[model samples]
Target: MSLPLAIISYLILGESDTWFTTLGTYLYFILLPVFWVGYTVGKKILGIRIVNLDETDVSFWTMIKRQLIANIFYILTLGIGVIVSAFMVGIREDKRAIHDFIAGTYVTFHPPWQK
Candidate 1:
């Protein structure tokens, strides 16, 4: 995903622009909401889904909040956020990332038969 954006930036803005990297960083923020919605929607289609820590359906606002926090940490950390995010998931009792924690959400395995 970032690859295409990088390529596009290079093509349009010239490879020499330092702002390309900044634009790529901003692009991440732009993609977060779209990504979360797509991820949740896809999970629903697959009969597995994400919910809140309380096992309630994830709200759009919550998803946005989660994405915002996670993205901020990601941008600030200069890509180390992936590792931190993954570690957050591993350490969480319910297996949630920092985004999930901020959003009060959890991903759970749901069998297709039950859906």
Candidate 2:
């Protein structure tokens, strides 16, 4: 995502560290997911979607908490939290990662109509 903008910026301006890259990052991580009802490009490709625990539509602030706020803790742990989240998803009955718990959401293969 950011790679394309970074490459273009490098070609055009001889620099990759610019607002274009940042915009790409935000578009990929934040806006796209919120607008798509928690399905990012990869998730959509994989036929997965995120839904709130109560089976409601995911709001922008909820996605922010899930994607951004919970990620801060993972970064704080220097990737250990990410490992834990992977393990939790693999081992837990609900198959939810740390971010899902934090945001009161979960990933599901069920289509929206079923929910």
Candidate 3:
């Protein structure tokens, strides 16, 4: 999604649109899952779902808190926080991003064979 948005923005608005497009793309991922469902449009389509760390239901308020810490906070540090979060996800054995940890949540995939 970020790739596609960045591509379109580059084609239409030149290189300067790259940052805006990138941020917008990330914001979209944050918004949909927190407000609409427990997954972004892409995640929903791919059978990926987000859940509480304890395998319990997560309320809307918790999701909002999660997004604030995970994504929105990036703006406070000029994206350094976001970079760090990505790095944490890459290095951590559990693959949980900083936002996941902050929100106390987990992302999982639903297997077709199981469901």
Stretches > 4 Å off in candidate 3: 1-37, 111-115
- TM-score for model 3? 0.61
The predicted structure with the larger TM-score, 2 or 3, is 2
State candidate 2's TM-score. Answer: 0.84
Error of 3 at 47 (Å): 1.8
Give TM per candidate. Answer: 0.54, 0.84, 0.61
Order the candidate numbers by lDDT, best to worst.
Answer: 2, 3, 1
Q: What is the C-alpha lDDT of each candidate?
A: 0.63, 0.85, 0.71
lDDT of 1 by residue, 55-76 (tens): 5555557666776667787788
Minimum summed lDDT over a 10-residue window in model 2 is located at: 26-35
For the record, the alpha-carbon RMSD of candidate 2 to the native fold, in angstroms, is: 1.9
Which sections of candidate 1 miss by over 4 Å? 1-41, 90-93, 111-115
lDDT digits (tens) for residues 1-115 of candidate 3: 7777877787888873578787787677666676644677777788877777765545676676687656667788799988888897789887787778778987777432333
Pairs of colliding residues, candidate 2: none
Residue 51's C-alpha lDDT in candidate 2? 87
Top candidate (lDDT): 2
